[model samples]
Target: MNALIFPGQGSQKLNMMKDFYDEYPQAREVMHRACDVLNFDLKGLIFGNDEHELTKTYNAQPALLTTSMMVFEVIKSKGINFDVVAGHSLGEYSALVAAGVLSFDDAIRAVRLRGELMENAVPSGAGSMMAILGLSPEKIEEIVGNLNGVYIANYNSPLQTVVSGEVTALLSAVDIFKNAGAKRVVQLNVSGPFHSPLMAPAKEKLSEFINKIEFRRPNVPVVFNVTGKVAGTLEEMRMNLINQLTSPVRWTESVKTMDEMCVNKYIEVGSGNVLCGLVKKIVNAEVYSTDSIDEMDKLEGVVKNAEIAEF
Candidate 1:
């Protein structure tokens, strides 16, 4: 079987979908609609030269979603499909659109608000996130067990776990993890503490917005972040999305679950290969990324061979 995955934050770059936006009418239509929905120069923000503005949380969320959906639209035009789909963090919104659970316009609008809420959830510099490498989840949990305000935010891979919390607690935990034999601990450049208890406010605020938008059952299963399981119903999917704001992303477990389901191929259809790298660490499967035109051309052959092999 084959699974399609989408990337989240930390994957955005200026001119990520410039080629598609300039060459394909479908991609250009999606970008135009996104700009109309957000009432901002999303096209310029994404394909323009201003890297600083494009990196902001609010801009990055919608921009990445637009790019991913543009790629998905292009892929769909080729008559390709998948057995299941999954996404990391902000990428989940894109996955929903691909699965027909949410319309592209609704997702674009929702993510814009979601980003704003998350960015303003806590005061700037008051909270932070750090990637702890070369440490087991259990060992990292043991070290963070007694630490106040610090919590695991992302179970990225066996060797990479991210922790988020107050700035002071994160700084203290960094030293403790390094002393406890961590290979490296690096702080992430983010606006707020995401996927942790500190995002409760964002969750509460986003709930109102989510309640207003309509959600439909996915045509294909979507491995969610909160439980690392497929949401069996629309209500379950909705609740999982709500809880995802304040819950650690079980990316490692999600990939493992996909493997257990006999998915032998993973195709990342987004802006970067970040998820491709993480999925490689978790599963021994054929991984491909389709972020650019050249990569998309290569994916056609990969998909055809995988289909012939009955993967």
Candidate 2:
């Protein structure tokens, strides 16, 4: 079976979907709808010269959603389909949209508020996230389990893990992590400490906003980040999304769960090939990413080949 995966933050780049927007009416329609829902000229910000503004938490959320949807529309039009869907962090919203669990309009608006709330969750310079290379997330968790203000944010891979916490705790834990065995500890350039206790306020506010929206059962099942498993029920899906705000992303486990579900092919439906790389490392699946027109052309051949192999 095949699964559609979506990437979250750290995968966005300037004018990412510009080619799609130019080449396909479906892609252009997605962007136009985003602009209407957002009530702002996202096209100007994304295609414009101000890249810094495009990457802001508030802006990036909707922009990524629109771009992912653009690619999704193009692929779906080409008859490409999937059995399940999953996403990383903010990418989860994109996944939800793909699964038909949430409408794009509701998702874009909610994530915009989610972004704003997360941006102001903690004071600037107070919260931060960092990547720990060549370290097991379990070992990293063992070392920082008792540390105040420090929490594991993403279980990205066997060799890569992310930590989020207060600046003071982050700085102090950096040395501890390095001394404990991390080969490299690089700080992430994100605005706030997401997926941690530090985001409680953001979670509270986002929950209030998201809960008001009705969540329908997905057309296809979704692998949630918190449990690294498929959602159990409709309310479970909604609850997982709200709980995701302050919970770590179990990316590695989620991929493993998908693998066990007989998903042998993965198509990353978003900007960069970040999720593709991560999926490759986790499983021996045929991984594909669609972020440009050329990649979309290549995807036609891939889907054909896969159908032949299945036949």
Candidate 3:
């Protein structure tokens, strides 16, 4: 089986989809629609906007959504079928959109507002995130327990977990983890601490927004970030999405669950090969990214080969 995966923030780069936008008229139209919906020059931002402008939370969120959706639309127009879909963090919204649980408009609006809420949830410089490498989630949690206000935010893999919370708490935890044989503990450059109690305000606000929106049953099972389980109902998916703001992203667990379900091929459907690299680390499979037209062609070839093997 094939699992379609999407990337989160921090994977974007300038000129990410320039080739596709130039080559595919449909992609260009979708990009234009996104710019109008967002009331900003999204196409310009991805290709010509300054680096600093592209990094803003509000812009990054919607930009990624547009790019991911554009790629999905291209693939879907070709009549592809995916057994299941999953995404990391912000990519969850993209997965939801692809799964048909949320419309493209609603997903874009929700994510834009989500980014704002997360950015404003905590006072500037009060909280932060740090990546702890070379340690299991359990060991990271053990260290988190020793720190006052730090919490595991993104359980990325067996050897990678991002901790978030009060800066003091994170710093202290980093110190102990380094002494305990961690390979590296690097602080992230982020506006606020995400996926922790620091995001409670954001969670509250996003929950209200989510309740006001309509959710439909997904076309394909989406492994949720909060639960790492396939959600079959709109209500369950909505609650899981709302809770995701304040809960750690169980990405590693989700990958493992997909593998157990026989999803051996994972195609990342957006910018950068970050998720592709992680899939390589987590499981033995063919990982592909749809970042460029060439990559997209490569992915289609892989899918065709998979079909041939099945026959």
* Candidate 2 lDDT, 255-276, residue by residue in tens: 9999999998898997999999
For residues 1-311, what per-residue lDDT tens digits would candidate 1 score against the true structure? 77989999899999897888877899989999998988899987787899888888988999999999999998898777788999999999998999999999889988999999999999998998999999999999999898999999999999999999999989877789998899999999998889999999999999888878889878888999999988888888888888999999999999999998999889898798999999999989989898889888898987787679976
Worst 10 residues of 1 by lDDT: 302-311
Model 1: colliding residue pairs: 1-311
Q: Write the per-residue lDDT of candidate 3 for residues 1-311, one digit (tens) a residue.
A: 88889898888779888887888777887799888777878888889859888887777888898898888888887766798999999999999999889988888889889988987899889999999889888887887887779888998988888998998777767669998889999999887899998899899989999999989888888999999999867889999999999999999889988999999779888898889888877878778788888888987887787689989
Q: Rate the local accuracy (lDDT) of all candidates.
A: 0.91, 0.91, 0.87
The runs of at least 3 residues in candidate 1 whose Cα sits more than 4 Å from the true structure, single-residue gaps closed, are 308-311
TM-score of 1: 0.97
| lDDT (Cα) of model 2 | 0.91
lDDT value for model 3: 0.87
Runs off by more than 4 Å, candidate 3: none
C-alpha lDDT (0 to 100) for residue 78 of candidate 1? 79
Residues forming the 10-long window of minimal summed lDDT in candidate 2:
46-55
Pick the winner on TM-score between candidates 1 and 3.
1
Best by TM-score: 2
Candidate 3 or 2, higher lDDT: 2
